[model samples]
Target chain A: MRRSIVNDPDDLVAEALEGLVLSHPTMLELDAEHRYISRKQKARDKVGLVSGGGSGHEPLHSGFVGTGMLDVAVSGAVFASPTALQVLAGTKAADAGRGVVQIVKNYTGDVLNFRIAGEISGDDAIDTEIVLVDDDLASDTGEDDGPGRRGTAATVIVEKICGAAAENGMDLQQVAAVGRTVAQRSRTMSLALAAGTHPGDDEPQFTLDADEVEFGVGIHGERAQRRIPFTGADELIEQLVDPLLEELELGRGTEVLAIVNGLGSAYPLELSLAARALHRRLDTDGITVGRSLVGSYVTSLDMHGVSITLMPLEDELRELWDAPVRTPALTW
Target chain B: MRRSIVNDPDDLVAEALEGLVLSHPTMLELDAEHRYISRKQKARDKVGLVSGGGSGHEPLHSGFVGTGMLDVAVSGAVFASPTALQVLAGTKAADAGRGVVQIVKNYTGDVLNFRIAGEISGDDAIDTEIVLVDDDLASDTGEDDGPGRRGTAATVIVEKICGAAAENGMDLQQVAAVGRTVAQRSRTMSLALAAGTHPGDDEPQFTLDADEVEFGVGIHGERAQRRIPFTGADELIEQLVDPLLEELELGRGTEVLAIVNGLGSAYPLELSLAARALHRRLDTDGITVGRSLVGSYVTSLDMHGVSITLMPLEDELRELWDAPVRTPALTW
Candidate 1:
């Protein structure tokens, strides 16, 4: 039997939203009717920033709906994309006379739904732009074939930088450009020791042997490119970092921001160990780390793994990242 | 066949500490020689706060060290208490002449070690007071035999409130008194759907049947007082909340603060759903929750469960709880 602490699996998303709103009443407002969350105190006449995906990734899109991050987030069910109608409602709620920027991760369902929502918003005379994030090095299919790279934890970095830009009164085009720039510069790869089980499912999406690990695993438990025998932390870090460095074309004297994110069930102790290895490896490679975030920012539901995201930083991007942010999941 | 991404099991705690210091360079300073973490910017002539225990409970003691929480934390090996020598060093590092307050959990080793450290600090002419936290109702030994109760997540609340009091320049006795009051009023009970595995251990600290849950499990994964067949969320909440309410003597119009904390591996989605159920139950019972914090405040390594901590709040306690705090795991 699947063990869970849920009322009805169908009601999990809505109930979680209620809890979030209740805990952060001053910062967030819930539209139960349309199923979206919006900032209680939105900036006037500034471009509104919005992003969302499956509901299981708590504090990702929803935990980020506050003063310095997203203006609105439309949550879907666990490991599922939000409907187009929900995204349209989010755009309407986030609008403040200025245009809205829709940040979409590169997933088939998410891309299609967010695009449809943008079209609807245009028809309603609310100017909207979509910034596609595709930074996953794991799913890299060269240049032409397949569906580009899957968007992973880099979406958090994009939202944060773009949110700061929009809050500083950047126009819609400028904010969207900032998002696109960060997304282009960022790359991520994940390794999983165990797979995550979706709600109402007794078995995991996939299983690994005790001495094995899956490399390049997607956030939704999609099959990875390969599985390898379990090794110590150093070997794993090398496997993740080499590809990321090559993708970013980074070398000695290059300043970059590194994010070591936990995929839900990995303890902070484990994440910290992974981060230590990442920093040491970067130092050995003569890279300069301008800033770093290590924790569970974006997560696959209870998956025991970690993802490394590196964004080669420029002065402008660094300054924007350093700007103050107040959200449930992040504060500085 | 143990599975983990650690350098060496013996070096796990030190490596994790190094990672933490690197991530929060401006806020935390590590004394690896003494096995303690201290604030980079210590407050002069103010009462200092110190707390720690085993290492697996990330963000508990170490993550709580910063401006509005602990001044220093002395970490032991995973799931083991720090030595008296280490605690003495932490006390010395945190002292600012106003004195120091040591917040200790109720486990025998922790209590003894912290007390010995207090005596040694007194010999060094540094005034030190130890506040014993024993809020676990699950391990309550009624009125007589054994230690009063095992400390659990309520230590977070006590540290936060007392740290605020100390930061506001309260004397050592005053700060220690505040911690005592909060501990006296607070009560916690935890339920584990699965047991946690310690580092390097091939087997879990304990085991449970797939369809069974242990109520009142200790943070160290000690066997629970009772086991029952698995039930849905509502029934589990009732089993937890009723005992907590009775222990707290809370009723209609009584103000309280509630924490729905995750044991190590529980997903955020599950924690949020549990928080929602907790709120609805409190409403049905006619209690006024002045403040609330829900997340993984304390954890057993990779345990799949949640703990509920309730503290009947007074206006003073609520004010202290609402004070500004900035730390690795918590910021507001």
Candidate 2:
């Protein structure tokens, strides 16, 4: 298992941090622990948005840390969630005396860690608001009384709009309400024809036959619900839309912000086709898609598949969506 | 070949054009015969900049046809250059009522076609200037003359900075001069571990042994200078950098803008490591890198290789590079 950096496992995070800092020196200011990379100037009189997760998804949590997006991004080891201390440090760094909002995807590990971080943050005068992203409702959230699998790609869009709202002088609680509304409105489902290899590991996390693909896979190589036959892209998208449409009950005159995200290894051509299929299907279903994006916004390493997330638009939500944001992960 | 669209060879361009207009209703306004997608709003008397090339590189010509980069992008067929008619129409669409400058990569087909377009455009009241991108030093450019092969990916950076400059109100002549200066000062070389296949095409344009990589391959699968033994990224960077340094005469106190572009299929991780190697080698050689980028900015389908481009920066050149232009292909 050969990786690019220092031989020591402990040094990997620090070295990667150094590299990230060098690349985005102007936009990012990192503290000594390498725990958090925040915007140089905190948002004065505005709710600070903080997001983080595993380290492998470059430009995801960290790349998104800059103007118009996350105030601070905490880092964990590859495919691992950040600790409470790390998240707390990030929250503290991003706090501008105006409350802090944590965008946590619904992975049990992420939810628990961020919750603890929030508890620790409560000691300060600032308030802490947590918006859990459980847009992927493939499985029961209450299964075994455990936390649901976190699918937070849409959290990026939500954070951007909500961040824009905060940037435009919205109060903390109001901005947070908008964020929660977006998270509730968005839903995503993913499929992978091949799994991504963990760094330093040659073999992929999982494998599939050339003609077969896994449906509803997680970023960490979790298996999906069904193994269906390989067919045209239309069928693949139908599998996704059928379930999603049922959940959203989207109908005529319902405008949606459509996102077709590659899980990694998926080519732009495929992504475009998938986006087109989803768009075509939505149109057939009499759903009005206000905005559609086809690209690798939220990837799962080099997993080969696509995830479609639809965010139903309301007045406030649409305004936030249209607001300007300056983040490395996503840019208008 | 299994292309994505359903149309005749002649109508393929129109179909694709319709798709682009449909997909990006806001950013682009196309003149199909003339291959132009202009910003919907009229320009503010700034220098009008236009760039286009073979059509296979999606989002390159069209995706980049927005606010900060190019004002006009004229696309040809898949891996083919556009006709003079297309180029002229594109010029008309992008002309902003100010003198228009065309940023062309110096391929025989592109040079000839764009030159014809410029000549036709010149006959009109519009002032037309041409900045040919002859940056690829790896291939001989002359029938019996100087330099090497046709212009490759470095054209993107030249287009980006020049577009930025033009948008910042640099006159047509000034923008053309900047484009020409960067094109001359810049040099690019590429190596391919695998050849790319056209959409729906199973066979690759070229092939390499599993353990070998072809160095200095062209965008259309042209043969490279060598196929060396497979090695680690550091060794590969050394191979890429040694040539680039010699070509550019980069040394201590020299500021350079480094672009590590994926020819497709190459993942971001590999690109990152390669950028790391490039930075280290440049630093070891006493060269000061002002900025660095690693991504698939200008790709060749899904070919698996990377190209390294270096532009020696001067005060005026830096200013032009810093200018803010709007286009889809290049952004700040």
Candidate 3:
């Protein structure tokens, strides 16, 4: 039996949003009819920013709907993309005369739905630009092959930088360009020690042996490219960091923003140790980390693993990232 | 076979601290020799607040060492109390010529160690006051009974409020008094859907059947007062809230600051739903929720459960709770 505390799996997304709005009444407003969350104080005449995909990744898109990040977020049921109608509602709610930017992670359903929403918004005379985030190095099969890289934790980086740019009154094209730039500069790779069980399902979406770890696992519990025998933190960090460094083409003295994100159930102690190893390895490689964030920013429901995202920082992106943000999740 | 990502269980705490100092270089300084984390910018001539218990409860003590919360945090091994010498180091590090206040959880080990540190600080000519937090209603006995109550998530409340008071330049006695008051006004009850495994241990500290939940479980994974068949969120909230209301002697028009905290592995989706149910129930009882925080403020390592902490808000306490705070885990 699945021992989830949910009242009903069907109502989980709506109820969670209700709780979010209740806790942050002054900062957020719920569009109950259309099923989206918008900033209580909408930015005026600025290019609106919005992003959402699935529900279980709490604080990712929804916790980010506030002053310095997304203006609206349309949440779907767990690990599933929201309907195009819901995304369209989000775009309309966030638009303030200026065009809106739709940040879509590189997932089949999400990409299709967000594109449809953009088309619908265009018909309604709301200029909507879709910025695709494809930063997962694990899913990389060259720019021409497959669906490109799956967007992972790097979406946080893209949203934050683009949100700051838009808030600074950048036009829709400029904000979208900023989002794409960061997404291009960023890369992420994750490993899963244990798979997460989906709601209403007793079995995990995937299973791993006690001594095995799935490297390059997707956020939705998709199988990694390879399963490797479990070693330890040092080995794991090396496995994650090497590919990220190669993908970013980073080397000595390169300034980077590093994120060590937990995939939900990984404890802080483990995440911290992973961070320590990652930092030491980076230092050994002569990289200068300009900024670092370590936490469960983007999660894969209660999956026990971690993902490391590295974004080589240019002066502009760094400045945008340093700009003040006051969201429920990323406040600095 | 244990499947932790850590390199070594013995060095886990220190490695974690190294990671924390690296992530928040401007805000924190780790004293490796003394095993305590001190604020980089010390609050001069103001009562300094110091707190710690065990290491597994991330963002509890160490994560709160910053501008508006703890001045120093002494971490022990996971789920073990720090030594008196370690606590004394924290006291010395936090003192800025005014005085220091030690916030201690109600566990016997923590109480004894903090008390010893206080006495030692007094001998060193540093005025130190120890504020004992005993707020777990599940472990409550008569006022004079053994240990009063076990401290749980309410420790977060006492520390935040008292830290604000101390940061506002309250005297040592005043800050200590504020801590005690909040502890008195607060009550917490936790239920464990599953027990957390200690580092290096193949088995969890305790266990419950899939359909069973242990109510009133301690943060250290101590068995609860009783085991009951697993119900849904509504029943769990009721079971927790009714006792809390009775213990608080609260009714219509009473105000409270409710914290629906996750104990490690509980997903945010569950936590938010729990918060929603909790708020609706509080409304049905005609209670005015003055403020609310719903997240994993305190945790038992990888335990899949939630703890609800209710702190009745008086005017002074509410003001203190609302004050600005910037820490690794909390910023507002």
Candidate 4:
């Protein structure tokens, strides 16, 4: 087997949390029993921001727990939802009498558990609002019965805006409202050149031929519905960006914040090329990229892919995004 | 051929720089002509910091240009040193009359070019000091005649410490001294599971069997001195740590700042596990980790590997490290 640097696959998440907390001792504290990471010094009398999901997306829910960001983040096994009990504890830990806003990605298990936790937290007089992020344009079937578009990299924007709003002492409703606005306005598209292997498994979840790439892939290692010819950087990034521009209904002179996100193993060089292509494409269409982030924030194990997230930047969203943040993954 | 999302390898570095500068317009400004990135707003009357190397190790010289870090960063092709003229241009760009401290990794080409540039910059009345970083324990041959250990991960610590010292109004000499001390005290060890393929190359630089790993590897995609049985995370980490402890001559109660760096394709889960193993091993050694960083700060071009950097933290060094830094790749 292509060995992973792990003891047992079961112990990976817990040990990782241990290391994360150890590395950021002053900024974070972990409750290993409940599988949640919370800020070391809890903020008081402010709306609490909480987010989480499967464990493989490192620096997402967990790395976001700090000042001016997530107050608590619950995690589960790789690509699996956190248990309702875990989410409940996380939600409770997030409350400090000002209510908690739950920012959850659009995934069935995550949705169910987060909703259950929000409902259960009500018994403690802790009000919670669920801001569901459904930004993945690739999964946008527009069908009412199906699971809606899966959330992708836009979760970073939602978390950042909500965290800033909460840190600004906005009430629960205001924080949740802004977060939902970000979620509603954002759209993302992803493509994978290579699938990631499970920790102990020898084979990748899927394989692509030398001349083809899996387009419209999600973060869970699932294959996309279609394959496209593998081509140059500009062409590939164009494929990802065209759909986002259309889905967002972006018009000429529109301004947006862009995120060129690296899916697990998309290194800095690849991400840089993708970012350049995206900016050039948008500029040609008379759209302005007002703000941007390029990195591997939201990931899917070692999947060699990238996703572009775009959200039309309103004045308030721009200011909120500009607000100071102090988190492991994103600090400024 | 293995498909890379690149249009032409010849234009890759320049385009990536364009993308990087575009993404961080407020913090960075690029001189496309000379191929160096400098701070958007120059800091005056303070010792300037300039560094650069090959292009593949992203977020190195380029991403570190900002308020409290590098003032200028030059670039070259992937895994190739920037030319003397590029270094000269970068040095001139960094000067704001307080002199410049050039942090050069200990590679033949990098060393030769940086020195030539530093010497030539004297004509422009820009005094420069070279803080040579050579911390790779794997390449340590214990002979004075050899080129010395190749600098790897410790360059980050050196750059960070020197930047803080310079920001604190230390003169060029003082900044260089502090930075050199960090480089002197620090040691790094790296290992690769799989070699990285270049952008347009079909094959990797090398390959390892499923049950073997290249121990004592460097940032370049070169083979290690020995191959060892592929083992679990704790054991592999133990192997890396053993040599460091011996080389550093650590005692039971000493404190150190550790950096668990990913060399390209090592993902967060793998890095987290490596960090956990390092902390546990150090704890068993009765050594207190004073401060630590865990991420892909220094990397090969998508090489699947990890490197550990250890430096005994002095009170002065600790304070400098704790100083605020604002750069794209590193900020606190």
Candidate 5:
């Protein structure tokens, strides 16, 4: 329960910025009217990578903004979307002679904010492209004339590959195209064994049975489709893999990038074991795993359980993934 | 509460071996007779890097025994030491025509077993050298005979650097020398906000009051020097930093590597924040941090807390750290 902080919530952002600077002084943190982090001024002719969502996912947006990844990360309050102005500030900070590509997860507010920001930052010289990531199939697809459920974890994988594509000197349009392709080709399913309590909240955001686990849960602890009895890990992984494979059309001979991400409180051993099991199931389906990453890449605070993300990799996507890129979250 | 087992203590090791191979078919698990994983009999003339310790710290002794880091890792059961026979088996599995360098953490049983294994393996036409890591500053270093206290989290950093060095074509003796120097320069201190619980055990290995925490704790939940009131993270980090700096004799312009390692259960956000705090303290002391890694490199089951390791790095250690290596735990 002990935390390092100044007095109130208003100062939370500034205090946290100070801590980040203290921890990673070499990594640039711009403490200006509109805060953003960058290693250097935006590069001309190189595609600009921008990503933003909520602030609670530390080292997610901001920590990931660096040389081979995001040029700027616009951070909002805990689980809250940044205002359009904040997004615009980040875009402006990251904009060089080349255009900027915004990697926005498909949260309703996030989409709206980034879209408005893009319009506001429109310039003849500065083109802006927003790639919406809605890889979570558990979110209602909204039958017709509606966007899919808000994007969650897969945004990270898309950003990583897109960042690499951009770093390899791809133009903004090309980078955005790669980003969209990666997002469309990826699918994620998460389960929650416990809810995460807000920093100041005494009680958990929600409740769950000690023995029951909610599958396909949201990053914000939203109610899942169903709470099922706790069973063996292999069964849980099988349930996750089945939905993901079906969604991504993965079968024998399909090359995949398997991700077994921890939702915070799950043990590493459990996550690795679940990843191992998930890989086996994918193998049984004759799916060829080109690259596999097993860790807590995108986490939901300290919630217990795990998520499986299957990225059916094409040749272009696999090459983009293998490119040398540096980010705090996805370091290879 | 759910676990798989064969119900015989003696059979536990064999069952675990089969489970490991079955769990990870992608990984070439060494068989029972020769527990070594290799690409083929004639893999390469690469300087073989090996690391081993107690088994409870999963993904450490096995997960990291792939391409880049350690060629082989001998795993002991739970927190117990791996037998010399197992070490010899792993050595044989990793012998790719070049010499083998053994990385032994400063635990008594592990050091003893690895030393005996090296002696035995050397007799079989393989040139082998052993590097003993005695980096835990909290241990009873006053004893001149050798390193006392458990070699907790710092072992991961040593393994990474040495593995990187080996990957850079360093001979077995050279890798061992670099590892030894790094170990002497490194010091670590850990804290536990909650005690670790062994699987199937009713209670934790130990206990802590609601407002108390164990400072300078061993990774295995062994008793620490003292139990004190739970102070805020800054004060606690200050306590850890002072001891580490004093022990390492860090001065202005001294380059050091910082490792803020989670002992399992601590969330990634918390670890990131702690790393930020530790970095700030080091900056104030005018120390230059060469490389900083924050993750659960070596864990003690589900212990909830973190350990900080500071290694005063010179040019050689820094060069070795940057050497390109591939392993499951570290890839850069």
Candidate 6:
């Protein structure tokens, strides 16, 4: 049996937003009624950035809001997309004179709601563009007709690079192009030793035996397509990296930005181990890891897992990644 | 059953250090043979700072080793203190021309080894001071003797303040004094929904009934002094705050720096809720929360819990706290 440190499951998202805004009062402000968070001081004459979805994957959309990241972030209930009206409020808030760019994760509900919000924003004379991110290598099916790969940790790379471009006074279309470029090139694969439980639920989303591991998992507490043997950290990371490397077609002398992200319950210790293994493996294959982030940025509600994301580093993307950002979860 | 993403429990610490050093190669360096981490570029004409204990509470001693924090952080195995020889190596490494200050937790083994190391370092004509941190209000016995209180999340505050002072070129005694002031004024209390498991352990340190919470818990996965009925976030915060308020003798018009720290498996959302509750409760008492941090800086493997630490702010201490820091776990 599992328990949560929450009062009411329904109030978790709103309360968390209030708490987060309160924690970073100088850098963030909240529109509580609209259920959105915006920058403490609105930017002017620059393309604004907005991206949000379900609430469970925190520090993702909300935690990414700040000076050099998202201008606005809206929240829906846990694991549920925000309403069209809510997204519209966020997009409107993100609008400076130049226009706004909405970085949407490639989920059906999220994509639909963001599209609707973008269309509605046109009535207010605000130009908007959507950059759909779908980088999960595990969700890649052979058929192009399917929903395509679900977005995962690569969203951070997208929002970060796009945020930097927009901050540098790029037009809406240019920022969208940069975001799309990052999304298209990045690929991620994840594995979980255990699944997460909902806030008030008594049981976990799924169960695994002591000797079994759930391989190729996603961020929304979904089961993996295959189960792999419980093994050493080096071997597990090898399994996740091999497919990504093949999919990215990363050849010798390729330089890439990497992320060893924890899916909620994986601690710094585990992420460090994975990062070390990744660096070793990439060096062996003559792929230089140019820049990397290792932590739980996009999480799955306490799921005990980790994801590896890789994007071939471009000079522009590297500059954007190095740009200063001050947010509640990430800052440099 | 609980399983960790670690192989060969004995190799976990060393491997983790190697991985951490590799991850932040620009800011940190590792002495694998001696099990200590130091700054990539050593500081000159500054008092050196060092802190370390067991390995499980990551991002603690090791993660805080960087430009504005500890000059060196030594590590032992899980829940074990580094040996005197290892600590001597770290102390000697931290010493530049100015001298060194060792920020130690108030644990028997840690205090003993750091003391021995400090004495040994004196033979090299290196002056050293020890700042013992004992901030856990939960373990306060109110006796003239007794082990007093175990240091908890307040170590971060202590390390951060001392690091800033040392960076400003304070003498060894002055730097140690600043750390002691922060440690003395700060107090922390913690409760756990569930205990953390060791790397290869199949069970948690302790079990809590469905409707009970382990209150007054420590960082080593030890049992709490008492069990309290499960309650809402607000009431739990009230229970924790009432005692701290009383203990610190905080008045209605006082200002303080607060930390809402995650013990381990507590996710971002849960911590935000805790932070929200803490802010509301303190505001009601008219206490101005001058500064606050909410995240998992120090952890106990994967224990699902949160800790609250408050130190009444002083102008000099506040300036030091706001000083720029660049470490793996903390940088602003």
**Model 4 chain B lowest lDDT segment of ten:** B1-10
lDDT of each: 0.88, 0.73, 0.88, 0.91, 0.72, 0.91
- Local accuracy of candidate 2 as per-residue lDDT tens digits, B1-332: 11221224354445555555555667777776576677776577787878888866665667677666778888887788888888888887778778888888777778888888888887888888988887776785457674345787777777777777777777888888878888888888888877777655546787777567788888777888778776777688688788889877877888898888877655554565666667778888788778766677777776767888898888877776666544443456
Query: Interface RMSD (Å) of model 1?
Result: 1.6
Summing lDDT over every window of 10 consecutive residues in candidate 4 chain A, give the lowest-scoring window. Answer: A1-10
Off by over 4 Å in 1: none
Give the alpha carbon lDDT tens digit for every residue of B1-332 in model 6.
78888778899999999999988989899999889999999999899998999889988989999888899999999999999999999999999978899999999999999999999999999899999999999899897788889998999999999999998988888999999999999999999999999988899999988999899999997777899999988888788888999999999899999999998899999999999999999999999889999999889999998999999997999999999999988989
- Cα lDDT tens digits, model 3, B186-244, are 99989988888887777778767778899999898888779878887878878888899
Question: Which candidate should be chosen as best, given lDDT against the real structure?
Answer: 6
Write down the worst ten-residue block by lDDT for model 2 chain B.
Answer: B1-10
Model 5 TM-score, all chains together: 0.89
- The sequence of per-residue lDDT tens digits that candidate 2 reaches over residues A1-332 is 11221224454555555556666667777775847888866667778889888866565777778777889988888778999999988888878888888988787778889999899899877689888778886654654776665664686777787788778877778878878888888888887766777655656787676567687877778887777665566678878788788888888889888787777655554565676667778888788778766666677666667788888888877877777767655666
Error of 1 at B303 (Å): 0.5
lDDT of 3 by residue, A98-154 (tens): 999999999989999999999999988999999999888888887586788899899
Per-residue lDDT of candidate 1, residues A1-332 (tens digit): 33778778899899889888887778889999777989888779899888998877776889888877899999999989999999999988989989999999999889999899999999889999999999888898887978899988999999999989998989999999999999999999999988887876777888888888999999999889899888877789779999898877898988889999998888888888998898888999899778988888888888889999999888899999999898878888
**Candidate numbers sorted by DockQ from highest down:** 6, 4, 3, 1, 5, 2
Complex DockQ per candidate:
0.70, 0.25, 0.74, 0.75, 0.26, 0.84
- Taking the tens digit of each residue's C-alpha lDDT, what string does model 6 give over A14-100? 999999999998989999887899999888889999999998888899999987889999998999999999999999999988888
**Which residue ranges in model 5 land beyond 4 Å of their true spot?**
A1-33, A123-125, A144-147, A200-203, B1-47, B66-68, B96-98, B144-147, B164-172, B199-204
Chain A only: TM-score per candidate? 0.98, 0.93, 0.98, 0.99, 0.93, 0.98
Q: Judging by TM-score, tell me the better candidate of 1 and 5.
A: 1
The residue pairs that clash in candidate 6, if any, are none
lDDT tens digits, residue span B1-332, model 5: 21221224344444444444444456546556644343222347777877777755765766666555777777676777888888888887777778888888777788888888888887898888887777777776595876575576677777777777777777777878878787777888988877666644535687777678788888777788887677656667777889898877788988888888878767655675576678777879888777887777778876778889988877777777777755555656
Which digits, one per residue and each the tens of the lDDT, describe model 4 over residues B14-131? 9999989889888889999989999999999999999999988887879889877899999989999999999999999999899999999999999999999999999989999999
